[model samples]
Target chain A: MSAESYENEYGNAKNALELKNITKRFGDLVAVSNISLEIKEGEIFSFLGPSGCGKTTLLRCIAGLEDADEGQVLIGGEVVNQIPPYKRNCSIVFQQHALFPHMSVFDNIAFGLVEHKVPKAEIKMRVNDLVDMVNLNGMESRWPHQLSGGQQQRVALARSLVLRPAILLLDEPLAALDRKLRKEMQTELKRIQKEVGTTFMNVTHDQKEALSLSDRIAVIKDGKIIQLGTPEEIYESPRTTFVADFMGASNIFSGKADVNGDNNILFRGDIGLEILLPNNDKLEAKEIKGISIHPEVIGIALEESEIKALDSWHTVFKGRITEAFYQGDFSELTVKLNESDIELAIHLGRGIAHDKEIVSGQDVMVHWKWEHNNILYS
Target chain B: METIKNATSPQSDLVVKNKKKFNVEVPLYMGPISFLLVGFVFAPLLIILFFSFLKTGLYGEIVYEFTMGNIKEILTGGSGIVFLNSFYLAVQTTILCLLLGYPLAYYIARYGGKWKVLLISMIVVPSWVAYLIRLYAFKTITGTNGIINNFLMDWGLISEPLTMLYTPGVVMVGLVYTWLPFMVLPLHAAMEGMEPSLLEAATDLGAHPVRRFFRITLPLSRGGAIAGSILVFIPTMGDWLVPALLGGSKVMMVGNLVAQKFTIAGNIPSGSSLAIMLAATLILILYLAIKWGGKEAMEKLV
Candidate 1:
């Protein structure tokens, strides 16, 4: 795919190593669309998206493997659009552990040094030091096939890091590994990044992996960053429907919003509920447009008769339990509101389930605090 | 009864053993086929070895006069130079094939068009013509007044016919041309099988394009090199027709020597001895090549 959206915000700050209005196109397809991001020094930044979402393409563009057709790439405050990958002080670890099978582990790690005309003594010392860092001692004389899969990955890591590049780019480096090994490598990768003190830009589809390992995550959908935030912000305050779903599989309900008293939004239709949302300071009092409720905010009721009073300002829904699916500690219930076709998804902890143990087709009430929902504009 | 005891005992072990016994069909057929192959292919070599130790009597029958002198003479006599010449020619053919054929193979493997079968056919279909005929064709192509010389002369590019044919240089060119596709095909396969990510990783690690090739591509393609060299070298060493036809009866190689001894020299015992020595030397070269290649070569990694 291609990145072709960011083609004009062209500033070449060295701190940025920026992608200025960069766009990539492969004929009729757009892989990346108008992505502008500045990777700061010593930050473990991640480009996270689903498979085929063009995270890899963006990484390749930065590595200079694939050139940006519409914009410039600035490295060290100079535009490196014409520079080849080798001239850039960047190293990439591919998903597959692509060790040179003919060489010993030592030679494979020392390869960049040899290419750079490094002294033999320095090459030996550095390779040995990296081997130790990767915890692959005594494997210098071994061929690639002789080692296990994990060893091969470490060798690949050592091979890239031995060059001591300004930034390290990893293209799904854990993709080839088994589940347990992938987790281990992820931790090892983070540890190595910490030790090296180099900026790392990683591309991965594993959202959990990015959340856990990265200092800041750029959650991408169709190659555009849906949200750029820390792990806590991405999880707790997703800005878009895709980010909300992708980060943790949250249920999204779309509805129109009307402002009521004191920054509260009257969210009508499909449960006919109302929610109070944080008021946007820029918009005038009457300008807010849409409201959303996360699944966790909706709770199940035993019966419609349990409420002491009905308040229109704080909304509630009379619904029937259409479906309940137990997922260990929480049960996800699909509640059909009245005679409407709309389904309200409610997540219930085991401690706070419905009072009367409602089965499918049984009448129930769904309610939440109006302030617990979110207000959206545009 | 004994039948009752058998019926009560476990039957699963019998079934397992029966299945194991049923797996022998492959070795059963391979056993006899391997024997036939060995008998037909190796028996002649054994006969040659046996004859080399015996004398050909005046009546044209082998009189078993046991001798090691024949082996000594073949290994150390005037014929030794002929063996060296053959070795030199083969080495040159192998090197020339690598230099020209490698790039061709790499290009076709990486940038080959959709009509690969048709393209490779262009190289291979020419081989269907007789080897002897091809040698004669080359002989004509490089002759003093051949098509090339005539074209150059008619185009006013040269004043006179150049000495283009019937030399060692011409023979070298002919040998390389005939075996070039052999080198190209295997090397191409090796290159096509290679993972492009490896090259990318090399460059990402500060290796320039040329450095990447030497460090990653060359070493990875070593298996192809070995296979290609053997494909060209083995036949070129033994091929006497091409050299004799192209070099204009020049005393070209040990292959010519082997031909002379076997056909015209009237020395059957010496010819047999030299043939055995040639086969032995080939086996020795093969052994050394394998021993040096090591276990990393199990997957050719082309």
Candidate 2:
């Protein structure tokens, strides 16, 4: 369909940006394939994926830096595929801040306004307000090189925000910062997005950053979004093995499922393990091909009586501790199952593992509630 | 106390031995370049400075009598016109080279891609041909019966041949052509050092192509432009060959006048005084250029 018709059909006033069947290719390799999504007016939405998964490429398509081969880009209820980047109402904060080294902080912020020929007094007011917003109040005359890395990023942010674009594209905005500063900027970025009331489309490979900062996230892999939902939904229930693995679920087992009784399904893992799963209304027992359990949710006990004392709803397995890592806040124990050679990662609170003497080569019983089991179809 | 003294004595001896070794190594490393600078460069300049204050004898020989007549003649006489003409030519050459070189350098740095090195080498390769021979070649191309005139006449574009050589314009062209590579190399370096994302950021901030060029690309590459101007300007001021071959007598520069005093007129004192003035002028210009270009760019060059 044409961009105009697409805009007219699906472009609601609430949606700040909408992309339809956007496909981009680099020579023969497809960098972004047939992707369609919408972002709300004031939402902090993120595209989460590993590096080279084409998340940045998708963001560039929205920014008009890269044109989509077979789709339309609509912003604020207008088709903008034919428009150049300078004419679009969206701005991007690059991964490397990409601040103009020659221009001062004030001039850098005022650059877009000057290009648009805004009034001189208004430009000053806007630039000063942004400098204050980004907390670089007294650094109006300082050059980009003189500022620290975080400070330079703030200037880059301020420079983009001064234009008041309809949507702000952040391409790994805090990826260049060190860990402590990245956390600080994540909070700062959320605050700034709220204050500006502009739609934020962020791209990042850091899952923690995405989970913490985004109101909604699209988990992308191999140039296609495999899952899109809120952080809680994606983390609690990933649909595919890739999403499960990428979201830090290490104990993934592929298996066949059979109906055991009226409401219970017995899953036979390929690794010679068996577990009972509660039958859900959405998925039939035979269609389920895999399961993932979060490492932190698994409980370990030293004795069979201690495991037997758990509720009947929990699935239990006997295993021996193969490796134990004592992290400062938590201890991680790798347990190899007795019935199978599968190794499961179990994270216990620091004092709990020390009190139990969970060392390597110790026999243990591992159990987790059935509700914590995340079923995967592919 | 006896053990402490024994320990200190051996350490002090070792420190003295290292210090002596360093003293020998310093001169050993610096010997050749230091000798060349003093013998070939500083000594000639000192001799020229001394000769500028000596008197010229009747037989066109230097008489070792202290006099400032040569300096006074250069300062107050018609040689001032030559200095002015040389300055004008240098300015014109620098401006022309800048106009031509900026785009070429930008193209090579921004879009030359895999051929960037080859393209830059192409610009530099022409300079490897001897300077005098290149000027002669240039003369043949623009001479009265040269390629351009013959082409124009063959095309029936003009009834008569155009005067293409021995003019001020021709001299300006030759100087710009000769010194253009110098301008390009520095500009290319500056532009190459610039992060390309700056241009993208500018575009994302609503700056169009033209505005982006002026606001981001131009100001960011100012260091290169300044360095290039200095490179082109200094050489063109002292260039005597281009004018002699292509400009004939119409376009006389300070370099040609100095050469005349030494070779044709055989006036050592007069030539030395003119040379001193030119050198002083170049030094002053270089100092001002560095001050204006800022220390950061000069540091990058070094």
Query: Which residue segments of model 1 deviate by more than 4 Å?
Result: A1-16, A102-108, A117-154, A226-241, A248-250, A254-293, A303-315, A350-363, A369-378, B1-11, B14-16, B19-24, B57-69, B113-130, B294-302
Question: TM-score for all predictions?
Answer: 0.84, 0.91
The CA lDDT of each predicted structure is 0.77, 0.90
Report clash pairs, candidate 2: none
Worst 10 residues of 1 chain A by lDDT: A1-10
Model 2 chain B poorest 10 in a row by lDDT: B293-302
Tens-place lDDT per residue, model 2, A1-378, is 233443454356498999999999999889899999988788788999999889999999999988999999999989899999999999999999998876788888888889989999999999999988889989999888788989999998998899999999999999999999999999999899879988899999988999999878899988999998888777878888999999988889999988755777888889877888778754676679899998989988987788768888898888899999988899888999996789999888887887887789998899999988888889
Docking class of 2: medium
What is the DockQ for all candidates, taken in turn?
0.65, 0.67
